[model samples]
Target: MKSPKASSVTIALILLLITGWLLWSSAAAAEETPYIRGAALIDTHGCLACHSGNLMGAMKVPPLRGCELPEEEFQAWVLYGCPQAQPGRAQQSRFGMPAYEGHLDPEDVQDILAWSQIAGHEVPDQAALSDLARGEQVALKAGCFDCHGPLGQGGIKNTGSFTGAIPGFSGEQFKHLCDDGDPAAIEEWIRHGTSERFLSGEPLAGLGRSFMSSQLTKMPAYQDILSDEEIELLVRYCLHINSLGPMSAERYEAHRAALASSKMEVTGQEDSLAGPSLPREVAELFSSKCIRCHGPKKQKSDYRMDTAAAAFQSGDIADFLEVSVIQPGAPRESLLYQFVSATEEDSLNEVFPMPPSEDERLSPEELKVIRDWIASGAPWSDKQTLQSAYSD
Candidate 1:
């Protein structure tokens, strides 16, 4: 899968590992200041992609920050794609609020709303050591892992891509996506979802789009999804993770576990990073409750949380859907818990809570079992689940 220019890519990765990438403690990161995750979400989802990055309206998309409507009315329009304009405005425009109804949970309405009230806030201009954590969340929330491979290590197959796979966040392969670690280049891909220069420039001589057309899985445009600040954080994250060199998928997960353990040490959360162990008490609970759908016996949608390794291996329906099935210590962050915890009306994109039926839904005690399990590091007993049962 390597390009002929492998040597050049290797040299670049070595340089990055030696001097460019620095993983520092959270305190060191705070020195760079922080932007709200809301703002970060704004960027990754490309909220400002069409309109001017300055929050000034462009083409026909209205200015995101200067609506004169009452707060309640504006908030309503935001949650329900801002299709309603007043006496002076046209009903149809090239771009308005992207549909948030089924895509982003209702809770996100507030974070996005809070960002709208602020002027010119973006993910910090300078990189934050703290970006490590938030960037991962951004990537996960944006579904980078689904296309790039788990944790952005980049091994997912792409039928017609040059390397025949999506590139990892880091490594020589990323040069196709970003040139010489240039921030603008990375930002171009993030905000526009494709680099105009790369597609039409001397390098590919206009074949970039052609090649992309034949690919089975392609990068989605974030113009409507992410905002500018979110793009920068993800860009920094890609550069930093690239310092790890090209790792096989197994090595990547081992590295991830090590990182998780280190995170626990830094935060002093004893159970935040899970290990491969499940209390015997809860093992049967999964067997009785979850396995009917997500167990080894009959994996629904190719997902089974039956094994510890399987739990972390992953799940995702789409962007804004919970990318991490079990986010270790964050029960609410985990899609598994989110699904089981939802009420009937909380359905996303028509996706209902677990059991998909009123009769079989977990009891409150049963709900607490998984929720507390997730909060307590979501320990599971097993190892080495494949990314999927049928495919590599």
Candidate 2:
């Protein structure tokens, strides 16, 4: 009805209004997304308890303050502990991280992802500044500091029934003893736990065994818990620490003196033995592997072996020792021997065998040593004799 130019201008104005409306709608939707909501959810869940500086247990809790990961990957990790993005690696949390699959909706996960991305962007890249900074973060997040020290120097862990003196990562002797700048070896140790040999085929021998044994808490096989990428980061951090050279002698000696003073408080001074002295090797084996769960802090099934007195005094352990002994010289009759010696094929119905977890079982050679010791009458050794032998 109107002129063509007037009608054309009206139509153009309507189209412009529609475009503006669409833009407004898109912005509003983005603003309303769950990521904003995730910020509140993080606080409500008390996630900072373990992930923050206020750690709950002896286990290391990886920090999430500046955590960076792909959006999909981050969402998956938040919803389901660990993602199976990679093969040959099982997903598990040795240091408890509860999954919030059903409890949190898709919207919740998205919100959390949003918050993490925002927070991550906020954190400055300190690792870029210095190797020490990177190493410190890795150590703290991986829990090295929990066992080592605040400075990655030596420290002692004295948990009621167990006493372990952790060596400094910076020590030249420790660096040489562990590995020779091989990241793969370091990575292997991180994933599968450290052994008496480095990835470069170096023998830990006497010093390695002593150092490994000094760790009061068993080093967990992190392959199940950490991603391969995370493990690589840790290796880089450790290598950097090693390059820094040994801890100051003064600090190391001070730490040792402090440990000596506190040793009695951690491991009760009960030194009574009922049988012949056990060999030093056998005692060291017990201290490193057996004492963690069976000793003072936690005694599963009322069995303990922290002290010679505890080993002989505990009725259950004493009975097991007696029943397992065959004619005072046969190790095969011993239930303790049988449990440690059982192969996967033979242990179908057995109550989860000794060292409970499959990853932490004693090696074949270690098992043989235990078997040999049991066969040799399972003699009880005094602490002083054992200590003197260790010093030699």
Off by over 4 Å in 1: 1-129, 248-392
- Stretches off by above 4 angstroms in model 2 are 1-135, 158-164, 199-215, 247-392
The total of clashing pairs for model 2 equals 3
lDDT of 2 by residue, 1-392 (tens): 79999999999999999998787455322112222355568888877777786656575667765456655666566666675332224244632765666667667765665455434432124534333344445556677666554445444343321123444455544465466666766776778777445522535255446535654566668888877756776776566445433322222222222222222222333542333456667778777666666766767657666666566443454364455322123455556566666667655644236766777688989988876665433556555222212211
lDDT of 2: 0.54
Q: In model 2, how large is the Cα lDDT of residue 224? A: 88
Q: What is the C-alpha lDDT of each candidate?
A: 0.57, 0.54
Q: For every candidate structure, what is the RMSD over all alpha carbons to the true structure, in angstroms?
A: 18.0, 24.3
Candidate 1 per-residue lDDT, tens place, 103-159, comes to: 454346545554454232232222333445566668878988777754554556677
Clashing pairs in 2: 34-111, 35-111, 324-334
